[model samples]
Target chain A: MDITSPAFKSNVKRALADKQLQRAMGNVKVGFVKKRSAARDKLPEFDQLRDQARDIKDHTLEYLDLYYEIYEQKVREAGGKVHWAATAEDARDIILKICQAHDAKTVTKGKSMIAEEIALNEHLEAAGITPVETDLGEYIIQLRNEPPSHIIGPAIHLNRDQVEASFRRAHDHLPDERSLDEVSELVDEARQVLRQKYIDADVGITGANYLVAETGTSIIVTNEGNGDLTQSLPKVHIVCTSLEKLVPTLEDVSTILRVLARSATGQEFSTYTTLSTGARREGDPDGPEEYHVVILDNGRSDMLGTEFQDMLRCIRCGACMNHCPVYHSVGGHAYGWVYPGPMGSVLTPTLIGVDKAGHLPNASTFCGRCEAVCPMHIPLPKMMRHWREREFEHHLTPRTVRTSLGIWAFLARRPALYHLASSVFIRALKLLAFGRSRLKSVPLAGGWTRHRDLPMPEGRTFQEMWRAGGHE
Target chain B: MSSIDKSKIDTTASRTRILNKLGATLATGKDRDARAEAVKTHLRQHKRNLVPERGNVEGAERIALFRAQAEAVAASVVEVKSADEVPEAITAHLREHNLPARVKHGDDPGLTGLPWGKTPTLERDSGPANGDDAVSLSRAFSAVAETGTLILVSGADNPTTLNFLPENHIVVLDAKDLGGAYEDAWDRVREAYGAGTMPRTVNMISGPSRTADVEQTIQLGAHGPRSLHIIIVNGE
Candidate 1:
């Protein structure tokens, strides 16, 4: 499940070979991208709102340390526990201790990207405690013993038959008579299995969609109400999130929610908008008895006051992923991290060492779809290019790419040599092709012709054609 | 007052320094409550009952419409012309759904007074429904015309589990019980609870339990009430 391992690449390559995954990913492009556009177009106010949302996050990230305190105080006032974790290890260890204290044998989890960032489930399993992923998407991947391929659609690489097969191997209680061909049957089976876990689980772990400093509320937006059951049924509830997830006030949380739903799923709002205060208050019949909030820094605190600070404004809508051409082709797992798509390309380098994730930044076409549809208006391509520039400056760029760039730079600097070389090159390439329409494979340039036809020089170079016209 | 509080950490001194740094950058000359204005405007649109109803339907038709919508959401449906007929309606629906027709702590005075002892009764105060063979009749606080939402207030009599944790949900609502707005419904709940005793849960459910979790496929009653039945008695 670790991104640094070779397993990550192999998993992606295997997914690439999966025709179903390719189709599902292609479907994502039309589904989310088109729907978000239509949703955004319907609300002209969306742009104005995006600007405000970004500013709110920018303001919050700048004063993150302050907001964290204010939020902590409010939670304490409501008799809740708050823990600050500077790294994923710290966060996981803290949660593990809490579980141990409660003598918890089974843990039920709601979908939280921070948990993925920290690899929480692995740590829990290492401790010999069972952690059941309750989100439908998260459940599928967890059952299949694979990491989430995409952020929003965790099992986007899986189809119905694959899921049925996975279930046949996993769920022991699944009756033979239950129709396994249709998707609904598969869903019902998973639900029945998960329902048992919910009842047995003593602790519930979830992620906050937005943490309101004003009310000290960690808000979760879910369609399935699984999060509600996770946090409610268990005696203990834990919220794990990044430092940047905080908002200044309740009003700000609402503003983000407006854009969060629209950009993420084209919905006005997610169905279960649970605003959980501390834990269950005195005489409260339904909520958890104890609530704990864990905020993990995970190198995000350093991101503040930097040019790339805008990246933190992201609501994790996956819009950038939906529109990204590189992501559309390669999908999320190829990015090799918990975060995938454009944001991952920018962040993976920053967090996991630019040297390790150097291939991620270079994978972009710089088409700017990620930037254009961003709900927070993050300049993604600019950030990616900045990372590329950083990589080149840091000598992280490979010898081959650098040598080619150096040759192009040298040629462009000397125009007379460029024209002389270019004209000679065109004539030589044309003669070599025998005036054919395309070059099947040429020396160093053969890589270009692997799947594409490199066109032969039609007439002359642009310099020659312009010179022939004599300055029109 | 505006939102839920998840946690409250204390780093007052660090917070002050960070805010000072932030103020030096952005809060130059004007109040930045202008930013807070965005959330204020959006909270306005999330209003559900703002949608105007087509035409007012009272009496059994209103009850029938509620029943039909509830039943469509995996809830059962029953129609009774009078409160006296409620027992028969309740008995038939439960028999069909295979749930025991019983009063699990009677919160609805109208349904309980309908001579339930004459027809058949399994138990009283079945405690929690526990997704077993149990169904409890409760009165809807108010119904929203636009979304057909039924507001349920949980007290000692009406356990919150009946509202949730049930495979099938049956609600008894009067037609004239339709409230004005979500705000109006909230006001009614606050009034019913009095100053000192607000119920543990006040649920405003328009439709049955729903989820789009399975590859974004819509499924009703993922957790709460696979079936919702509204027995309308001339909206009495």
Candidate 2:
């Protein structure tokens, strides 16, 4: 919950040295990219569905007010309640009150980024209620008291031995010498430990992948059934989600679902895609007795009607980060927020002020793989550029960057001076290179040359070469 | 408990403030009534978007595609001539897995009418699962042939718990209930439960519960059923 984005550079440096994290992040490339490509090849309409999904989100946001009203009415009609929060504190207070009303002692939670945004677990603990994370990845991070590194895979930065260590520390009742070397053993341990917590929990909280206005249902897609168990067995279920997750109809949500799983995990569909409308119906055998939805607008409302509004269209697929070279190299904690990867780079600066998270937008190389693989077709690189421009205007950039950019801007305004300066600079670099075609290092460019050699210029600038080659 | 003043709830204030912010930000001149009308029109149309050619076949071709896709996801399926054969299928499946012949189910009419008496050795109990139940059976409301997804709505007759709380989950469906896409299954839901209203829960189970969280290696039975078995009763 603390803002560490300002230290993104140092975070990245530490992440690069973390051997376990680098090894874990390597799995992202071979796992997600190849599976997604295969899934996309199988479905001929994957690209078309991406366009349709984008339009669906855009249309819903344009008239978000109307959709909210409809969704609220339908929710209430189905014997459910809807709560709106203007900030993270407002949401936390509403949930705490609901838990208090139910006299809840233990609250079980599914993996929700919004919950992390509001810091719900800490709030509930401070109020003397035990909050247990039910998802395997979430449970691991909760035990370690760490923020999630990946949106979907919270424990993606840790190795198996690390998880075994965490389990031994947390579950002292279990025998110390129990075999926990295999992944299956670790999974079984968590499953057994969390099963009773689900039944004992008085309230359950989950995030919605999509909120259908037609049926007022909150949908979640997950491979593990922990979310379903958390919501079903508990006496009360609370959905913590943002306002932008709304869609017009079930058909619209269906269209998006076709692409969501393919892009996220390359599965045709997740093992469990449940649509919960409200509380348990009359004569229902078993389910939550009461249902409530808490919608938060923590700086998201301002994103509407701006160039950054397209960022709101993101479905939180994590595909952008899966395909992101920077994310794979540095890992997610470097982004320093609840969301990580390309989506976090653009969104963190908007939610938490750009002054605090200015380094996130600059971290990208703008290779555009995030935009290329985005199911919603969000222009992530363009939005990051917007953040950079805002930082420049606000004078939040460091003095060195500002001075360099200022000097470049000055020369660009005069084409003749820029050409002359460039040619002279190239000749000097050639002279420094001796007979070699590469410069081992250059003044004020140690950062680049430390990792790889800088190619030397061929004694002439591009302008001279173009003229010599008769291209002009 | 005494009732609190409805107007003083903080959510009401937050709700009003948020809608105001949304109005100011978007600046859409259309009044509330016009926007509501547009939403209503869209809901009324409920038009299906592009349907993939993968599952666009009809009749036996559609059924073949569904079986192929479902099996592709590690879900095993069996076809029988009528409901009379369902018990035998379940018995055979259990025998193969070395699991118990005892199973739990809800009071759904489709499941209740089955000739389960034919398998005298198998024991069937009716109700929701209580964590120890090895296997649970439920009649699917319908299924989407597009992705081999089973559609089950919650009610007293077909409890939602039976779908998740068992190690092995068995779903029986009529061949006529299988449709080409999720849109078709949704139409069936509306016809059964009316528009704008849904059951408490609708589960679209594709395959058995699984997780790839550990090293991105998928392992089945992550706090839910490890195996999902489907029995389709074909029409003569």
Candidate 3:
């Protein structure tokens, strides 16, 4: 589900052209950026809260293992089962066994990135179980059979007409006489279909926003209430969450929640914050009978003691992604991994494999907005630079980039040669352009000229001006 | 193949886990005593600041105006005096939508009068709020004077799903519940539930479930109620 795949690029490009997607993206501008501003405006104490929130995540991540154990114990005591999964495969297997035990014919799912990491639904489907995504965005993409292009909005790539088409295609009971003209009618029909799936589901799965050690509760925050249904409606409820989601207590969960909605959606809180402990109680009317939490380590535990450990504090608010220029231009799917934007650049290389996702680190313009909006305050660019260094050391960089860097490194040590070569290159480019202001095309620099005009180098190189002006 | 875990993995999940536990253990001490004293302190500090709830609506136009505003957000506005009147309102709303008994569990006694409004026909309230048929009539913990948000919670009385599961949601706000900001509203929730005593879920729904998922079309209730209505009954 990496964003860099040709499949992902095509999906994003298609999404960019989609009328509904544009409409959806416009909401992000208001919902995330503007609402965050409004929420921040109401609180004079907000500045202090950011530092406090950052410190809490930092201190918590400094001892993630201890809290996880406390969380596990509290959950076990609450009549819930906690399975510690060290890999995505472990997590998938744990969920599969639960479904098998239930003899699950159908599964309803809430949005869980860990499930994406393990490719959970595909695995479930392989075993002959029909897994239906309950969230609207997830459901839309499920119809298209595509991976989520964005963390928050999965089907952001689809337009309304396409959605109408998808509903008509999958919804067998759709009346032949039905007019696809009204969007409301289309949405209503989809709702009826999903509502049935929600009830018929044998197993419901979700991701935990935060795992509480004190109460032994797995908390999920969703505006749609789909997550609650995904975990509560079915007989077997499985939580596919990674290890870092654990927060020590309800109080700690509160501090995070205050920042989370503000950072993510600019709301005081999400529409629903469902904290389920184990399963349904004796007299409880609407809830699951069995509950299982699959805590996926998936390289996170190893990251705790390392320089990359700061990444563990991320809350998945998508703030960093929204404010990131590289992400704004290219969108989430371009990052070629589950996580995207600057956070993805730093995280993908480490979690997936530095060499496997090296391009992610290079995708950033390093404007630092991702860090600016990041509640956890991860040093994203620095981590990416560390990856670049590792890539260069391993000679894993593309031959042209490597050769160019090598030449620059050689010249940098010899300033006279550096100036000489830089000047010659500028002169060569000027001659090639032949007084034309912009280069519409360039052979070696096709990556730049592909979608934009290259600004021809103006006047003598900066080195020449500096030397002549007596600055150097 | 089994990989050896860190020695501390046996103790806690990671060092971060240890510090978080210790931090929580410590933060509780810092806030507990002060927080316990906070309720009375807040009650006393803000007692005089409370708004005198006295705007009156004598006619149907005013009722229609309120209902229209609520319906704009996909909420159903019910005009009812007592809890006894709730069942009829629920029935009328369902009938107008032309939906059969879509309610799974009627925590609201208003729903119990309907013969078929029980389980299997049972709509779980924890489910995502959707459906043109699913109608919820809930007691507002507080409403925002500024934004018109209806604050609700999950319990035996109001199913968590009622907030999100229905395309149309009917909330009953006792005009006095209206507050200034989200925090002001939560102060009421805190006053009701306390610092550590949070319900399974608390939903602050301002309008219908909505997503501008397509071209930012501003579609209401993409995942929540397509309509939200709040009825403010005159004082008893």
- Which candidate achieves the best TM-score against the true structure? 2
lDDT of 2 at A4: 89
Q: Report how far residue A418 has shifted in candidate 1, in Å.
A: 4.3
Q: Any idea what lDDT model 3 has?
A: 0.65
Where in model 1 is the C-alpha error above 4 Å?
A4-13, A41-44, A413-421, A470-472, B1-164, B169-216, B227-236
- Minimum summed lDDT over a 10-residue window in model 1 chain A is located at A3-12
Tell me the whole-model lDDT of each prediction, alpha carbons only. 0.69, 0.90, 0.65
Residue A147 lDDT in model 2? 94
The local lDDT score (0 to 100) that residue B73 gets in candidate 1 is 39
CA RMSD per model (angstroms): 6.1, 1.6, 7.9
Clash counts for the predictions, in order: 20, 0, 58
lDDT of 3 by residue, A75-186 (tens): 6665667777766776777778778776789999998878888889888988999988887778888888877767776765456778888887887676777887666666
Question: Which sequence of candidate numbers ranks them by lDDT, best first?
Answer: 2, 1, 3
Q: Which portions of model 3 miss their true places by more than 4 Å?
A: A1-48, A266-268, A427-443, A449-472, B1-134, B138-168, B171-207, B222-236
Residue-level lDDT for A425 in candidate 3: 84
Put down candidate 2 lDDT per residue, A127-147, tens digits, no spaces: 999999988999999999999
